[model samples]
Target chain A: MTYCVGLLLNEGMVFLSDTRTNAGIDNISTYRKLFVFEEPGERIIVIQTAGSLSVTQTVIAKLREADEDPDASPYPSIMQAPTMLRMVEIVGQVLSDVTADISAKVDRMSQSATASMIIGGQRKGGSPRLFLVYPEGNFIEATEDTPYLQIGEHKYGKPILDRVVTPETSLEDARKAVLLSMDSTLRSNLSVGMPLDLLTVLTDTCQVQHQTRIEANDAAFQEMSHAWSKALRESFTSVR
Target chain B: MTYCVGLLLNEGMVFLSDTRTNAGIDNISTYRKLFVFEEPGERIIVIQTAGSLSVTQTVIAKLREADEDPDASPYPSIMQAPTMLRMVEIVGQVLSDVTADISAKVDRMSQSATASMIIGGQRKGGSPRLFLVYPEGNFIEATEDTPYLQIGEHKYGKPILDRVVTPETSLEDARKAVLLSMDSTLRSNLSVGMPLDLLTVLTDTCQVQHQTRIEANDAAFQEMSHAWSKALRESFTSVR
Candidate 1:
C-alpha cells in the first residue's frame, strides 16, 4: 500500500509520496516511488507511483532509459515531448504496455501486475498541469474546481484535503496541507509509512524549485506532526 | 452504500447510521438502518447495518418476528438470549441464514447479497459490549484498546476517532466524536448521507437514554456542522 498526492494550484504544483512497499506484513521494505525528470528551462516532469512495485519501477526505468538515450526510440523522449499531454500519453502507454507484459507472465500464479501514477509538471510553452494516470493507459487532469490528485491508501487522508485545499491556496500552505494530510494517514493507517519525498516547482520555471526527503526522524516534520495532532484534539473539543 | 459506527465507552454506548441506500448513483432511496430492541430491565440490543439492503432488512425482520412472536422460532429469540454473547449469536445466526437465502437467489444474476453490522448493548447482569459481525456469520468484539466498531464507508471517518475516542471517554464526548466523525464521512463521500439516526444508552441501564432522528433540515445539527467546519478551518491554518 502507498499514499501519494499532487496538488495543482495558482502558485505552481506540489508532490509528496511515502517510501514504503510491502508484498506482505513480514516483507515490508522502503523504496523510492517519486521520480523527477528535468532539463532546466526546457521541461520538468515529476511522477509519483502506487501499486505493483515491479510495474511502477519498470515504467520509471523505461522512461529514464528513453530520457537518457534519445536514439533508443523513434519517438521523442519524456523531456522532448511537445506538451504535458503528450508526455502523459508516453508515460501512460509505457505503463499499460509494462502492465500487460508482466500480467501475462504472472497470470499462471494468479498474481496481479498493475500500477497507477500521478504526474505533474510543465514544459516550456505550456501551462502547468497535474494528472492521475490509470493502469489502462487512460488519465484525467486536475482542474480548478478539484485541483488535487491522490492515489493509494487515500481515504484516511482525504477529508483534510477536501476541507482545506483549493486552486488559490499558497505554495507554502499547499506544502503544509499535504504534510498534515499525510500526518492524518500515518496516524490512522500502518500501511503508509514515512521517509517521504516532498517536491515543489514554481509555475513556468520548468525547474525543480524545492525538494527534500523527509526522513522518519526529521525533527521539523515530527514537530509539525505532533503540533497538528495536539491542535486537532483541542479543536475537536471546541467544535460545538 | 452506508456508514454506521458504534462506540463502547465507560459511561455508555453510542450508535449512529446514515439513511441513504443506492444500487447505483441514479437509483437511491432513504431507509432506516438502525434498530433497537429493549425490555427496559432485562436487556438492550442496538444494530446498525451496511451492505445489501435485502440481507439486512430480512435479518431485522426475522429478529423482530422472533422477538414479538416467540412461537415462530425453535431457538431462543434475540430478546430471550441469556447474555450479550448469546444475543450476538442469535443475531449472527439470523444474519447468516438470511444472507445465504438471498445469495442463492441473487447468485444466478451475478449480484452481491452480502452485508455487515455493528451491534452494541448490555444485558442486566453483563457489562457493555460492542461487536462487528461480518458476512461469514463470525464476529469480533471491541476492546479497551479499540473501543469502537464501524461498518461500510468507514475509512474516511476513521482518523478522527483514532485521535479522539477511548474507553475513558465520556458518553457526551463520545456522542460528539461519532457525530463529527459522521460529518467527515458525509463531506467526503456521496454514498453516505442524511438524515441520520443517533442513539445512545447509558451503561448498566438496560435501556436507551437518548434517541433522536436527525432529519436533513435539522437546525441544531446544521449549526453544529457549520461550527465544526469553521473550527477545523481555523485549526488547520494555525497548526504551523
Candidate 2:
C-alpha cells in the first residue's frame, strides 16, 4: 500500500509520494517512489508511483534507458517528448509493458505485478498537465473541475483534496493540501509510512523549483501533522 | 454498498447508517439499515447493517419471527437473550444461518449473499457493549482501546474516528464524531448516501434515548454538513 498525490494548479504542479514499500508486514523497506526527468530548461517531468515496487522500478529503469539511448528517437522518451501528454504516453507505455512482463513471470504464484502512477510537469511551450496513468497504459488528465489526482491508499486522504484543490489554487496552498492529505493517509493507514518525497514544478519554468524529502522525524512535518490534528479536533468541537 | 458505524462510549452507544443501496450505479434505491429492538427498561439493542440486503433483511426477519413465536424458546432469540454477549451470539448465528441459506439458493449466479452487522446496546444487569458480527457465526467486541466498529465503505470515514473516538468520549461528541465520519464517507463515496438513520442508547437505562431519521432535506443535518466543510477549510487554511 502507498499514497501519492499530484496537483495541477495555476502556479504550477505538486507531487508527493511515500517511501514505504512492503511485500508483507515483516518485509517492509524504504524505496523512493518519486522520479524526476529533466533536461534543465527544456522539459521537466515528475513521476510518482504506487503499487508493486518491482514494476514501478522497472518502468523507471526502462524510461531512463530510453532517455539515454541514441537510437530511442523512434520510441518516445520522457526527456525528448514534445509535450506533457507525449511524456505521459511514453511513461504509461513503459509502465504497462513492465507490468505485463513481470506479471506473466509471477502468474504461477497468483501474485499481481500491477502498478499505477501520477505523472505531471511542463515543457517549454506546453501548458502544465497532470495525469493518472493506470496499469493498462491508459490515462486521464486532471482538468479545472478536478485538478488533482491520487493513487494508492487514496480514500483516506481524498476528502481534503476534494474540498480544497482547484486549477486556480496557488502552488503553496497546493503543497499544503497534498501534505495534509498525506498526513491524513499516514495516520489512518500503517502501510503508508514516512520519509516522503515532495516536489514542486513552477509553471513554464521547466525546472524543479523545490524538491525535499520529509523524514518521519522532520520537525516541520511533525509540526504540520500535530497542528492539523489539533485544528481538526478544535474545529470538530466548535462545530454547532 | 453501505456505510454504518457504531461506537460504544462510557455514557452510552451511538450508531449511524446511510440508507442508499445499490446493485449497480443505475440500480440504486433507499433502504434503512438501522434496526432497534427493545423491551424498554429491560433490553435495548441496535443493529446497523451493511452488505447484501437480502442477507440482512432475511436475518432481521428471522429474528422478528422468533421474537414473536411462543415456541421459539428452543432457539435463542434476541428478545430472550440472557446477556449482551448472548444477544450478539444470537444475532450472529441468525445472520450466519440466513447468509448460508440464501447463498446456497444463489450459488449458481456466482454472486455473494453475505452481510455483516454492528450490534450494540445494553440489557438489564449487563454493561453497554458493541460487537461486529461477521458473515460467519462469530463476532468481536469493541474494547476500550478501540471503541468503534464500522462496516462497508469504512475506510473513508475511519480517520476521524481513529483520531477522536474513545470509551471516555462524551455521548454528544460521539454522535458528532459518527455523523462527521458518515459525512466524510458520503462526500467521498457515491455508493453511500442519505438519508441517514441515527440512534443512541443511554447507559443503564436499557432504552433508546434518541432516534432520528435525517432526511436529505433535514435542516440540522444540512447545517452540520455545511459547517463541517467550512470548518475543515478554515482549519486547512490556518494550518502552517
Candidate 3:
C-alpha cells in the first residue's frame, strides 16, 4: 500500500508520496513512488502512483521508453506533450493499457493489477494543473472548490485536508498541509511508511523548485510529526 | 450505514453513536443504534450497533422480549448475566443468531445481513469492560494499550482516538474525545449523521451516569464542532 497526496494551490502544486511497498507484512520494502519528468523551461510533469506496483512501474517504464525511442513521432511522451491535459491523457492511457495487459495474465489468480495516479505539472504557456488519473484511463482535474487529490490510505487523513485546504493557500502552507495529512495516515496505517518523497512545482516555472527525501529518522520530519501530535492533543484539550 | 465508538477508561466507559440509517443516498432515516439495559445498582449494559439495521433491530427486540418474558430463566438476559464477560457473550450470541437467521432468508439476493456491536458496561462487583462483538458470535476486548473500539466508517475518526484516548483518561475527556471523533466522521461521511446518542457508565455504579441525544442543530454540539474546526485550522497554521 502507498499514501500519496497532491495539492493544487495558487502559487504552485505540492506532491508527497510514501515509499513503503509490501507484498505482505513480512515483505515490506521501500520504493519511490514519485516520478519527475522535466524539460527545464519547457515543462515539468510529476506523477505519484498508488496501487499494484507492477502496473505503475510498467506504465512508467513505457512512458520513459517512448521518450527515448528514436522513431517516436506518433508516440506522445510526457516530455513532448503540448499541454498539461494532453500529458495527463497520455499518462492515463498508458496506465490503463498496462493494467489491462497485466491483469489479463493474472486473471486466473483473482488478482488485480490496477493502479491510480496523481499527475500534475505545467507547460510554459499554461497555468499549473493537477489531475487524479484513474486506472481505467479516466481522470478528474482539481478545481477551485476542491484543490487536493489523494489516493491510497486516504480516509484516515482526509478530514484535515477537507477542512484546511483551499486554492488560495500559499505553497508553504500547502506543503505543510500535505505533510501533516501524510503524518496522520502514517500513524494510523502500517502499510504506508517512510522515507517520503516531497516535491513542489512552482506555477509557470515548468521546473522542480524544491524536492527532498524524508527518511524514517529525519530530524525535521520527526519534529513536525511530534509538533502536530502535541498540537492535536492541546487542541482537543482546549476545545471545551 | 452507521458510526459507533466505545472507549474503556479507568474512570468508566464512554459510548457514542450516530443515528442515521440509509438504504441509499435518497432514502435516509434516523434510527437509534444505542440501547441501554440497566438493573440500576446491580448492572448497566450499553450496546452500540452498526450494519444491517434490520438485523440489529431484530436482535435488540428479541433481547428485550426475553427479558420481559414472565417465564424467562436458564436463558440469561443482559440484566441477569453473572459478569461483564458473560454479558458480552450473551449479546454476541444473540447478534450472531439474529444475523444468521435473517441472512439465511436473504442469501439468494447476495445481500449481507451482518451487523457488529460495541458493548460495554459494569456489573456490581466488576471493573468496566468493553468488547467489539463481531457478526460471527466472537468478540475482542479493548485493552489498556488500545482502549477504544469503532465500527462502520471508522477510519475518518480514528486518528484522533489513536492519539488522545487511553485507559487512564478522565470520563469528561473521554466523552469529549468520542464526540470529536464522531464529528470527524460526520463531516466526512454522508451515511453517518446527526441526532447522535451519547452515554457513559461509571465503574461499579451499575447505572448510566449521563446520556443525551444531540440533534442536527443542537447548540452545544454545533459550538463544539465549530470550536474544533477553528482549533484544527489554528493548529495547522501554527505547525512550522
Candidate 4:
C-alpha cells in the first residue's frame, strides 16, 4: 500500500515515504505518512508509517495528543524524550497498545488494520539513530553494517539499497538512492503511488533540515525517471 | 523459497529459476526448479515451481507418468497436449489437485505451503504462450501488456522486469534482463539463493533453444553481479 525507507548515513539520516492509500482498485486517496515532531534545536523525530491507515493515524494522533497534553509528565512526548532510542521505545509502546486495543474490538478484522512505524532522528545531546518499530512493540536499530530500514512494499526497491547504501554515504546520495529505489517499485507495482514525502535530518542539528513533497509531475523526478530508463536500456544493450 | 521468471518474447520464451530450498536457515539445500518436457519438433513445455516442493514434485512426477503410460486416454500427457494453452491448463489442474491433497494434512502446520507454477511453451502449430498458475488451479496468461510471469520470491527482483521487460523484447535481451533481475534479488534476500536454471524456447521451434545452469562460481554470473553493483553505485551518484 506504501513504501517508506530510512537511511542512516554519516552526513545525516534520510526518510522517504509515498502518500498513496487504497482500499481497492477504484477507491484511492492520498495520506501523508511522515509525521515530524520537532522542538526546533532541542529535538526532531521523524516517524514514517505503513500498513493500515487507521492504526498508523490513530497512533500518530495519540502521539500528538501527548505532545499537546498539559498533564504530560516528565516523559512528556517524543519531543521531550531524552534520546532517540527512548523516543523509539515510546512510539513502539504506543503503537503496540493501540494495536492491541483495536484488535480486541475488531478481532479478525484487526488484521486489515495493523500498522508498523520507522522512527529515526536525533535528540539534542544524543547521536543520530534509526529504528524499525514492529506492530508487536519490538524494534531494531540500524548499525554501520546495515544502515537502512525499509517498510511497506520494500522488496521491489531493495536491490539498489543493498548495492549502494552504507553508513558513510552522504545525505544527498542516500536521498537519491531511495528515490530511485522507489521509482523502480512505482513503475512495476500499481499498489504503490506518489506524491512522496522526503525529509532530511542533520545529525546533532536536531531540527528539520529539509522537507519536500514530490508530486506526480515534478520535473526533477521526471528527468531522473527518463535518465534511468535510458541508462538501463544502454546498459542492457551494451552487456552483450 | 525461490525466484523464477518466465518471459514470452518475440524472439522466444525465456525461463529462469533459482534452486535454493530451506526448511530453515540451517537446513538449506539445492533442488532444481525448472522441468522441461519436449517432443522435439512436436512441442516443448517448461514448468517452474515455487512453494511446497513436495506438491510440485508430485505434480511433475504425475505428468511424467502420464507421458509414459500406454493406456493414457484422450487427455494424455503434456507431450500429447493439443496446444500450449492446454498444457498450461493440465499443469494448473495437477498443481491444484496435488496441493489440495497435501494441504489437508499440512494445512495445520502452514497454510502457505501450497505451490504455484509458471508454465510456458510452444506447440508445433501454435505461438508461444505463458501462464501463471495459482494454488487453486486457476491461471492467467501473459499478454502483450504484461509479458512476464514470476513465482516464489518475486518482488525482490521485480524492478528490473518493470523497467526493462516487454513482449516485443528480443530473446537475447530478455535473457540478460532476467539474469540481472535474479542477480538483484540474490544480493538482497537470504531465502532466494543460487545455482540458477535458465531455459529459452523459440517460437514454432518446438524445442529448447538454450538452457543454462548457472553455478555459484560461474564466471559470467560473477562478472554480471559485480558490474551491476558498480552500475548501481554510478547511477546513484550520477542522479541529481
Candidate 5:
C-alpha cells in the first residue's frame, strides 16, 4: 500500500515515502506518510509510515500531542527526547499502544489493523541513526554492515538495495538508490503510487538539509526511470 | 519455498525454477520442482511448482500415473491430451484434487497446505501455451500483454521481468531474463536458493529444445550474476 525507505550513510541519512493509501482497489487516495520533527541545530527526527491509515494517523497524532503539549501527554515528546534511540522508543510505544487499542475494538469482528515505521535522525551530540520499528513496538537499528531500512511493498525494491547499498554510499547515490528502488516498485505494484516525499538529513545538521516532492509526472524522475529501464535491458542483453 | 517462472515468447517458452525446499530454515534440501514430460515430436509439457511439498509431489505422482497407466486413470492421459489446454487442465485438476484431499485430512487440526503450478507446453499442430494453475484449479494464461508468470517469492524478481519480457523477446533473451530474475530472488530471499532448473521449448518443436541444471557455484552463472550486479550499480549511478 506504501513504500518508504531510509538509508544511513557516511554523508547523511536519506528518507523517501510514497503517498498512496487504499482501502481496496477502487478506494485509493493520496496521503503524506512522512513526518518531520526538527529543531534546526538541536535535533531532526524523520518518521515514514505504512499500513493501516487509522493506526498510522493515531500514532502521529499521539506523538504530536507530546510535541505540542508535552506536559499534558503521558510520554516525553519526540522533539524533546534525550536521544534518537529514545525518540524511536516513544514513537514505537505510541504505535504499539494505538494498534492495541484499535485491535481490541475490532477483534470481535475479526478485523485487525497495524502499522510499521522507519524512524531515523540525529541529535546534536550523536552520530546519525536509522531504525525500522515494528507494529509490536520492537525495532532494529541500521549498522555499518546493514545501513538501510525499508517498510511497505519492500520486496520488489530490495534486491537493488541489497546489492548496492553500504555505509559508505554517498547521500546523492543513496537518494538515487531509493528512487530507483521506488521506481521498480511503482512499475510492478499499482497499490503504491506517487507523488513521493523525499528528505535528506546531513550527518550533523539535526534538520532536513534538502527536501522535495517528486510528482507523478516530474520530468527528471520520468527521465531517470526511462533511462534505468533502457540501461537494464542493455545490461540484460550484454550479460550473456 | 521456491521461485518458478514461465515466459511465453514468440520464439517459444522459457521456464526456470530454483531447487531449494525447506520445511524450516534449518531443514533445507534440494528438490527438483521442475518436471518435464515429453513425447518427443508429439508433445512437450513442463510443470514448474511452488508451495507445499506434499501437495506438489502428490499432484506430480497422480499425473505420472495417468501418463504411465492410462487404463487405470479416471482422466485421459496428458500424453494423449488433444491440446496444450487439455494438458494444463489435467495438471490443474490433479493439483486441485490433491490439495482438497490433503487439506481435508489436515483441516481437523486447523492446518492446511496447498500448491500452485506453472504449466506450459506445445502439442503437435498447436501453438505454445503457458498457464498459471491455482490451488483452486482455476488458471490464467500468459498473453502478449503480460508474457510471464511467477510463483513463490516472486516480487524480488518481478520488476526485471515486467520491463524486459514480451511475446517478441528472443528465446535467447528469454532464458537470460529468467536467470537474472532468479538471481535477484536468490540474493534477496534465503528460502529461494541455488541449483536452478532451466528448460526451453522452441516454437513448433514438440519436445524440449534444451535443458540444464545450473549448479550453485557454476562458473558461467556466477559470472553473469556478478556482471549483472555491476551493471545495476553502474546503471543506478549513471541514471541521473
Candidate 6:
C-alpha cells in the first residue's frame, strides 16, 4: 500500500509520496516513488506513482528511454511534451502498456500487477494542472471545486483535504496540510511507512522550487507527531 | 454505506453509528443501525450493523422474534443470553442465517447485498468486551493492543484513532474521539451522513450509562462540527 497526494493551487502544485513498497508483510522495502522530468526553465513535470512497483518503475524507465532515443519523433517524450495535458497522456500510455504486458503472464496466478499515477506540473506559458492517471490509460483533471488528487491509502487522509484545501490556497499552506494528512495516515496504517519524497513547484517558473526527503527519524516530523498526539488528548479532555 | 465504531475502555464501552443509507443517490433514507438488548442490571448487548440494509434489518428482526418466542431453546436469544460471548454467538448465527438466505435471492439479481456488525458490552460480573462480527458469522475480539472495532467507511476516520485512542482511555474521552472521527468521515465521503446513534456502557455496570441520538439540527453537534472546522484551519496555519 502507498499514499500520494498532489494539490493544484493558485501559487503552484505540491506533490508528496511515501517510500514504502511491499509484496507482503515480510517483503516490505523502501523505494522512492517521485520521478521528476525537467529541462529546467523549459518544462518541469513531477510524477508520483503508487501500486505495483514493477509496473510504475518500468513505465518511468520507458519514458526516460524515449527521451534519450536519438531518432524520436514529433511526439518525443514527457520532457519535450508541449503542455501538461500532453505530458499526462504520454505517462498514461506508458503505464497502461506496461501493466497490460505484466498482467498477461500473472493472470493465472491470482496476482494483480497494475499501477496508477498522479501527474502534475507546468510548461512555459501554460497554466498548472493536476491529473489522476488510471491503469487503463485514461485520466481526469482537478477542477476548482476539487483541487487535489490522492491515490493509494487515500481514505485515511481524505477528510483533511475535503475540509481545508482549495484552488486558491497558497503553496506553503497546501504543503503543510498534505504533510499532516500523510502524518495521520502513517500513524494509523503500518502498510504506509516513511522516508517520504516531497516536491513543491511554483507556477510559470517551470522549475522545481523545493524538494526534501524525510526519513523516519527526522526531527521536524517527530515534533509534529508529538504535538498532534498532545493536541488530540487535550481536545478530547476539553470536549464534554 | 455506513460508519460504526466500538471502543472498550477501562471505564466502559462506547459505540457510535451513523444513520444514512443510500441505494442510489436518488434513493437515500435514514434508518437506525444500532440495536440494544438489555435486561437492566443483568446484561446489555449493543449491535451496530453496516452494509446491505436488507440483510441487517432481517437479521435484527429474527433476533427480536426469537426473544419474543416463549419456547426458544437452551441457546436463548440475545435478550436472554447469560454471557456477553453467548450473546455475540447468537447474534452472529442469526446474521449468518439471514445473510445466506438473502444472498441466494440477491445474487441472482447482480449480487450486491451483504452485511457485517460490531457487538460489544458487558454481562453481570464479566469484563467489558468488544467483537467485530463478519458476514459469515466468524468474529474477532478487540485486544489490548488494537482496542477498538469499526465496520464500513472505516479508513477515512482511522488516522485519528491510530494517533490518539488507547485501552486506558476514559469512556468520556473515547466518546469524543469517535464523534470527531465520524465527523471527519462525514466530511469526506458522500456514502456516510448524519443523525448518529451513540451509546456508552460502563464496566461491571452491565447496562447503558449514556445514549444519544444526534440529529443534523441538534445544537450541540452543530456547535462541535463548527468548532472542529475552525480548529483544523487554525491548526494548519499554526503548524510549520
Off by over 4 Å in 3: A70-75, B70-75
Each model's DockQ score: 0.86, 0.85, 0.87, 0.66, 0.87, 0.59
Q: Residue pairs in steric clash, candidate 6?
A: none
If both were scored by DockQ, which would come out higher, candidate 1 or candidate 6?
1
TM-score of each: 0.98, 0.96, 0.95, 0.96, 0.98, 0.95
Q: Compared with the true structure, what per-residue lDDT tens digits does model 1 show for residues B22-76?
A: 9999999999999999989779999999999989998988888888888876546
* Model 2: lDDT of residue A172: 84
Query: How does each model score on lDDT?
Result: 0.92, 0.90, 0.90, 0.86, 0.92, 0.86
DockQ of 3: 0.87
Question: Which wins on lDDT, candidate 3 or candidate 4?
Answer: 3
**Can you write out model 3's per-residue Cα lDDT over B127-187, one digit (the tens) per residue?**
8899999999899999989999999999999999999988889999998899999999999
Can you list the residue pairs that collide in candidate 4?
none
The C-alpha local distance difference test score for the whole of candidate 4 amounts to 0.86
TM-score of chain B in each prediction: 0.97, 0.97, 0.96, 0.95, 0.98, 0.95
- Which scores better on DockQ, 1 or 2? 1
| CA deviation > 4 Å runs, candidate 2 | A70-75, B70-75
RMSD of 3: 1.9
Deviation of model 2 at A218, angstroms: 0.7
CA lDDT, candidate 1, residue A140 = 100
Per-candidate iRMSD: 0.9, 0.7, 0.5, 1.6, 0.7, 2.0
